[model samples]
Target: MVAGLVLGDAWLWVAVEWSPPAYAPFYARGGFDALTATLLVAALVKAALLWLILRAPAPGPLDRRAKALRRLLYLAVAYNLVLWYAFALLPDAVDAAFQLALWTGIDVLYLLVIRWRSRMLRAAAGAMLAVELAGMVNELLDELDLRELGSGGVVGLGLTLGGVAATVITVVGQRRDGRWSRGTQAAGWLSAIVCALAIPLDILFGRISSGSLAFPVMIDAVGLVITVWHAATARELPAEGRPAELPPARQRVIRVAVAAAAVLPIIALIQPEQTPHLTYTGWSMDCYDRPSFGDLKPEERDAAFLCRARSTEGGVPPVFPDSLSDQQILAYGRALCRTEDRDERKTILTRAGSARPAWGVDPWDLVYVCPEIIGATYPELLRSTKETEAANAAYIAEKNARCRDPWPRTKGVVQASANYFLFVDGDTGYLVHDPGDEAADEVAEQATDKVYDDSALIGVAGSAVLIGHFEDVVDLCLTVKAFRTPPPQRTAGWDEVNEVPIVSRSGRLTVPEMGEGGDVGAGAPMPNLAIAGKGRYRLRVHVRVDDAGEEQHLVVVYPGASRKRLRLKP
Candidate 1:
């Protein structure tokens, strides 16, 4: 019967290996492969040994009950193999369902087999069946995502209750039988109790893999111990109860087959690899480009200084005085604001602000004020500053208020202020002026290098170029800013740097126009820009144009380290 069980187990292994996602070792490695193959081989060898054992003469006559039970065990093993094969051929959903059913059936059969076979085997098998049932139940629950009762929680409770009940029953039955010395019965009961106690601990804290065949493994271990003890102490069964035994040669052959079956799946998993295709789209830019302040000519410095002053005044456009050249403006801005390293700043002043706003303040003033506000709100904003409990509470309250009513009517004023400060901080290349005085030159240099390495300027062809508008540029800029400053950590005060203005290229429809259009940018307001520290992050942009009779476009961008892009469709 052991041989037959082993052979059936081997067939089960063959079934699992043939199923997809293709068991290439490159994809699936470690214990998953090892255990799978081991089980397979063990099953095959056991079957071969059983056949040989059946061919050998029995030690003595057997009772009808014993013979009947043996036949049923063989039949159950056969049925299990058929079910396994069917599972392999079915679709994934169907196969999963079938496997679940099959395991449940196997558990029932195992319990019956143990009861009719040997007391020790029965106990071992019963324990294993309980564990397997617990695992299966847990797995099924997980697949359904019934979070109220998690798989681990349910399995743990079930195993604890079942193990205790089984142990109690076994103890009562053993005591009644009086088949062994009192000491032996005591030891058996003690072992059973120990196993019962271990079940809950293992379920709660054991590093056991969730939904794995841990119960079966425990049962197997216990079964082995019981089998060895029985063989050592008990002589052959009484003449009427004696069962058939495997021949020496068949037993050896079975062992060899089982070993081979166990190893095959693992070998299959170690196979080769394959290549996959990838794609990307949308506007991406780097924020660190520091202009050289030291080499700036006197006239250029004058222009930059004037631009900084005007930017701080709040309403003046990003323009320098007529007396200073573009170079001076660039240099002065870099020196005053520490943002000279970022090319975007240069571009914004030189090209975007060519017309210049009459009331806008200089960029340097905006940069200085921005950091001060951040620092004041969260003192820990300063580099290396430890957060105090009072500060943390104040920060949380501020953040909650901001989140609840994020959009203020004074957005234009705030943006103007931010732009002015940015201009002044260009040269220092640091976001804020700190007492430590660690220059942001390194960050600036790295940011500049990344921009040059990854970006390219491409002109749009035909009439489509006309579609681009000032609002689009503004949206893109805001998006870039948001990406540069990710959301603050939970323990830290809320920083508004994550907020980015969402703008429509046409300017006809503001964010309030979202979902009103059936055009290119319909539905909810899109998040056109995003900022993240590390790991995969998403940026969603939605735009709507009423002129086109309800047209909208939704753009989704996935950005990763090294500036990799993945564009998802809406």
Candidate 2:
């Protein structure tokens, strides 16, 4: 009965007092919440009690009737034990490798406890049988199987296999040894029949806590022990005859009580938990815990999701954030977005230099990707202080060792204005059109294109050019240089390499009439790059996103002409 009380305590606490989200602090490692560990201490206490029971002196051999009643207790205990095991393995793996190890340990413990109690080879064999007798019946009730035990199927199967094998063997061996008892076999089968009530109760009770059922069973268990003791000790009890010797009404009452004690906890154990153990697997910019994700591989589901959590799954994303700290980066992004002036925006984003933490998003990419944080009420959110400056000085010393190189960048934007190669939809590279080519307008209408679309490396989706990105809002280092002839080819240090056509119809490398892109540079002063005249030209764009996510774009526009799309590397 004390053992029953201890087991009941865990269910009661979880059903009433335990809040999975409230305890998230204890379990959420990175984005993972290992809910199974929540009940570890309780399980240990239960194990301790069992250990004590195993060490305690054996009671005298039971007469047939007493042994039959005891078997019912064991039967209830068995059902509850398996239910507990199912629950223990309910939550999906937090760390797949670690969870697999835990699975082994927990399963072994389940078998050991059952076998130690039965102390027979048959008991050891029964440890593998899962509690499928009730589960198969679960299909008939609502047509839904034990999804409650999602992903825990293997664990349950192990238990059911072990339990059935051990029980069957134990019965056969005991009978062969001339020591088999009909009472014990009857108890197990009867307990199973009682356990089946879990289905109807599940339907009727709907979504209530297991406590509703467990507490009652605990009460019944206490009453049964007391009543049976009183009956046994009565001064004028019959020496033999089982229930035939007792009053009919009392016998019926005892039978009912035994049934109640056997079924209630088993029913309670299968009751749904308030928060099912969740395993999230997918590419998410935020956290998600659902059953669907359980179908994905551990690595796929466990990929670092940061930025912000979203309810809907995302499309092929530009980048999936891996870091947890985005507060400062968001503040910086908002500051850059205060005005539409492109230059000013760049100034604000890169103002902090090493003083600002990249937080896994380059400031340029933030202007497009994290557009939600732009145009905030608080623009100058986190201005640097004297202390921060000193700290940044220390930080830059280490950061610059690898980030000091410059490339042919946004140098003297010869013609930041694009009359011929206009700002198309998804394409952002230099483009040229024949006398009246409407390819730009036609493709622009297909998808919402971001100018600085940081979709990993630059990709050609329709007409838009997608670019790769830095880890965070790190400042870019650029050195734009013009070339009359094609620049010498350098094969290394480029993350993306693509070529786009730049048309100069009247033969002059001056700012052309670039159609309004409705983007950041709308109100900004234009900078012009002049390094050519007349005829067609091609801009070979070489991009580098460093280890820390800082970006550098090398633009070398030389005299050339091509209508075909060309992409060498990205």
Candidate 3:
């Protein structure tokens, strides 16, 4: 009882720090308000009784056999510690091996210990009983996570009953023989083994595993059974023969240590935000206003050039022209002739230039109109005729003329290369992209207008947040692409681009740009996107085809970055 009181105090501390605050007041004041004061008073009364019992206890040294048994108990404690450490460090198979060894070692130790001082078995059994009771309570609290509560409950009950039976048998044998009997001893050892097995069973089947109640359940069952049996059969020993009490200094130290251990968890529970912080880079672009092709701050213009140069050299070419000045690039788009071989390239550049009074079309608008022409195209350099180069020159001249100063300078600076472009049509619901297929032109065009009217339905462009830094952007891109393919199909050869979860709410999560069959189903709350470190990221909409029925395209947009989507299956 004294050990339990001390252990309870320690547990109370852990509960305060780790458990939900909804139960805080229950622990603080013993229950809801003064009406529950009786509980606290009862506990205090019990503590007083136990203290009195201890004061009245004084017994002489045990026989040689009893001394040997006590030494075995110490050995059992050492074995348990070693087993715990081994379990922590080894793999499952090794851990299991060590666990079995520990269990057998402990059983042998207990058998030896009981031969000399059978009364100690009762104390051990009582402890086990307390543990079992605690386990039951924990299981109830975490029932939602358990797979088969009925089976788990049956096993728990059986183990508890077995411990009780073992305790009873041990007491009966001790009374009949003036010492512990082999049958009682066998039952006790078997019960201990059953309790050990129960730990793994609970872990595999229970809902929650932390601060587990399994150990408590086993200990309490054994403890109560043995204590009851001994009390009924054994007489009290003479005071002179009782075990010696700890010195005042040692007792004080233990009490203080226990009290501190109990209080720390309460402090931790009050403040949990200190655990850790995570951040990521984000990016975004706006194309609603006219494209001020050359209108950039000196520094920004220089940075754009650097970005373009770096892009071309680093494998992925810049989406826009890097060789020409921003002004020249914009002007060149306006100068292109419709009949030239490079007419397609000229048209793309012209549309990307400053916005016109009628330029309500978004960047996606241009992509939709010229899907095949928008993405990277090889400028055919057949040396024999220089045919492609001559044609491109003519097209560039015509593009420069038509793209000239389409939007006024008063509207604010136009971004040359934001890395992302958005296109929205007020009525057509059409959308297009730089890297989209020519075969999907009609679908892209229809999606453009839908972008504005039903942005919420469109997954790719939903409340976009930019994650800054190229590496993170690439990773986000890859994660997003992963959602498009099934687990079995995903491999090194699979598409590198994948969709990632961008929005999460109550019971639903959504990702951008998944194929038609990839729906984010409603369920318990989904996991958030965890960008492990500091950086920036931009969330935006993009276009994707409907695999089920290409004719019925949908737009999906989310409110914020909190939306959840299907996890990367692989």
> What lDDT does each candidate get?
0.34, 0.38, 0.32
Give per-residue CA lDDT, model 3, range 1-570, as digits (tens).
Answer: 234235554343232222334444454544333212222333343233223222321234566644444444334333332344545565555544443454344334334434334566555644554444444433443443445334565666665664555444444434434443232233334444444544554554322211233223223223222222222122122222222455787456435433432342233222123221111001102221222223344344333332332233334333443334434433333333122345455455555442221222222222222223432232231111345445644543453233222112312111111012112211222221212233333433444434444324332332232222111111111112111112222223221222333322122222233223222211111122222211112233232222432111111222233434332212
Q: In model 1, which runs have C-alpha deviations exceeding 4 angstroms?
A: 1-68, 83-128, 134-149, 152-248, 272-570
Q: Report the number of the highest-lDDT candidate.
A: 2
Indicate the worst ten consecutive residues by lDDT in candidate 1: 275-284
TM-score comparison, 1 vs 2, better candidate: 1
The better-scoring model by lDDT among 1 and 2 is: 2
TM match of model 2 to true structure: 0.25
Candidate 3 similarity to native, TM-score: 0.22
Q: What is the lDDT of residue 564 in candidate 1?
A: 25
Cα deviation at 40, candidate 1, in Å, is: 16
Per-candidate TM-scores read: 0.25, 0.25, 0.22
Residue 227, candidate 1: C-alpha displacement in angstroms: 19
